[model samples]
Target: MTRLPASLLPEGLTAAVEEASGARVVAVRPRGGGGASRDGAELDLAWPDGRTASAYMNYDVHRAGAGDDASFLREAAVLRALSGPLALAGVRVAPYYASVPDQRALVCGLVAGCDRFGAITDPVQRDALAADFMAQLAALHRIDIAKQPIEGMGPIESADVFARRRIAGLRAGNSGRAWDPLIHLALDWLEANIPADMPPPAIVHGDAGPGNFLFEGDRVTALLDWELVHYGDPMADLAMLCLRMLFQGFVPLPQAFAAYEAAGGHSVDRARLRFWRLLFQTAFARRSRYDDPDAPPPPNLGMNLVYSTIHRRVLSQALAEAAGVALPPVAMPDAAPGAHDRSFAVALDDIRDTIVPRLSDQQAAVKAKGLARLIKWWRAIERYQPGFHAAERLEISAALRRDFPDHGAAWSAFCQAVSDGGIETEAAIILCNAHAAREAALLADSMGGLAETRLAPLD
Candidate 1:
């Protein structure tokens, strides 16, 4: 076992973890898939009674903690609320050990497994794991939220009230930002399409999807990532699972739904599921003002861009499906070589060819790849975006019945029209889809498998 100085963590944090674990920390291995807001690690421990154990730690670097009844506090609180009930229901969840709000950290018993369902290689084994995961999800959804009250999530309400609250919450988050017209249209559609009725709300794992659950062999070890937990439609989880399947492969939706229903979960409500899918995607895909040339990128710049591209494209597609419109094929621009093209190519080669291989640390290598993606995007914008902008501007100008001196001006006007409902629904949907498709093409090479992923048919 290894122990280090107290300074490695915030004051009193190390002691808090050790006291909760009743063991000494030996090894701290960085857990992957952290974003700018959060990070964590797996800690190998040695107990005095000749027992060995491991625990996972989550560090909220953004410290979305502290405020009374803060929404972010639910991340750790929900685990505490559900762990017992879920275990009693034959579902496995990580055991909560401690919450250190002062340090924005949480410790829980580590469940050994990997989150990448795509890596299971064997078809039979992968299917088994996904089925098992569905069982766990079903069991979770079956838990009676009414009977097992979770505090700090606000009082339970009817589905319509819940829907309105969700809309309000999203508006609050979008406040004080440069509005993206697609977001405005998406929000309107979401507000209009709230189901007349919904099943009884349960504790929905709001971000449930591939890469958020762990599995080993034929068993799902535990579901991970509870940052977005809330009491709402459990179908939200299924919908998000579909989204994750597009990014990280899971079993086909038909098979997955079968497993869930078989496990005593409610039958799949396709319309409701799609509504939540649209909600989840649109809520996350809103544009931020980070494209300014002088603005500095956070360390994980690639994650930001790739996630944005995926969400934007998915949101566009979801709108089309919901609106009963078809997206006409979008045009691709021919590459226009620039003075910086060779320099861009040289840097990309150095990253994929030279830098990533020499990095032994898995987490570091992941960061290096992300850096490479940032460069690829820059390269793309230089070589192809001019043509893309030109074509897109022409399309928008015709739709708006006005001509702008520049693409930037045309786009700004188009966005204003869409946001103001000056454009018809079909035209807006097609325009948004066309724009998303072009953006997707630019990021396709960097996104790889995820670029071609489509929503599973809801049959």
Candidate 2:
């Protein structure tokens, strides 16, 4: 668990706990690796009558804008609506206590007996756990969105609208940047082949996957991370599940789909599921901007870069699948000569030997180690990136058969051409795959283990 500095804790947290539970907060510890959008902490409180209780606090630091509280409220509302139904189905969700809208913070009862499901070692137990999770997901999808309405779920007209809105949102977020041809090609394909028939919008857990839930033994104690909840096609959640399996080794896709259908969810629509999987992967690839000047710096820059690389690779694969083409093999770049700068090596040694041991907070120490690893990666790739990029740009220019001011301009023109139907689908697929492969190779050289594992394409 990560520990937060006293100054980082919200000022009103203690007072809020006192008011809500009539208890005084005795301790507050930050939970490491909080979700993508929020910071979490466990608050230990002592009641006035002498009893003790624990509450979990989640503060929206990234998703909340300057004066808008809508994001926080939206999640709170979803939790409120599904609390009873989920509890009844033996799918536990944290009870909503109170919201500090001003700070964009929410307080809920701290759930116990739940941890990451990946820790299970026994094969039989792991399979049972996977089934249990599928059953819980089915129950969630079976929720009557009309009867138990959640405020601020936004418009839920159809799956196409939802998919388009998401694509539009991603485009809007990155407007004025160099266009990504793969995204455009994928979008064009999606628009041309929108599924005509889809199940009515169900309550979709926008990010349902392995790490998002909590479990103990073979049973899931609680489903966590409801921040992205919204109403959309149920397959959206299923796509996310498959995506999770693609990145993280979890249950097989066929088994998971079987379990879900057997537990009362809609039958798997292969075409729609494929479309959604591509869309989700595209959205992730497009939206990940580690160097965004407008946003705050990420807490862990190395991990951010790691995820960006993974998303880019996945996005390329998804696009190729959509285009019904196979990605060309990625050639490994020649290794760079030994590093002459001893400073990097010295710093890494200091971090591992001197700094990490001194740090009391395990999370901070882990982050420090991550920084060291990033430095090591820099040592490995610093000498090669310039040459690699030049070669890549030359290759891209050759593929496009045109000269442009720079790589960005060339890419934008290529994507625009593809979107305009000037480029053949197969040609676009090959070019995009080459681009994504080169980028992934650079990242893999910098950070190990990213390019080594190849998951079989989802059937």
Alpha-carbon lDDT, every model: 0.75, 0.69
Candidate 2 Cα lDDT to native: 0.69
Minimal lDDT window, size 10, model 1: 61-70
Tens digit of lDDT per residue, candidate 1, span 1-459? Answer: 244625344467677777766877777765543443355667776788988777888765444221223445676777776665445776677887777665557778888888788877899997888788888888888878778777656677665566777777776656444567677778889999999768788777777768888888989888887777777887888998887777777777888999889988888898889888888888767664466454444436677678778888889988887889988888887976866989988988998888888976555777888888878777788888999999999999889999988999998898878767789988888888888888888888788777777877766
RMSD of each: 3.3, 3.5
Question: For model 2, how does the per-residue alpha-carbon lDDT over 1-459 read when each residue is reduced to its tens digit?
Answer: 433335547576557556755667677776544443455667776776887777788775554221136545666777766665445645567877666665566777777665555566788987888888888888888877666566655555666677777777656554555356777767667767778888888877777878877777888877777766667788888888877665456777788888889989888888888888777777666634545676665556666666656776777777776677876675546755556548778988899899999987645775786687678667656665655656666666776787777766776777677767877788777877777766666567445655655544445
Evaluate residue 395 in candidate 2 and report its C-alpha lDDT on the 0 to 100 scale: 62
Give the clashing residue pairs of candidate 1, or none.
none
Give the CA lDDT, 0 to 100, for residue 8 in model 2.
Answer: 46
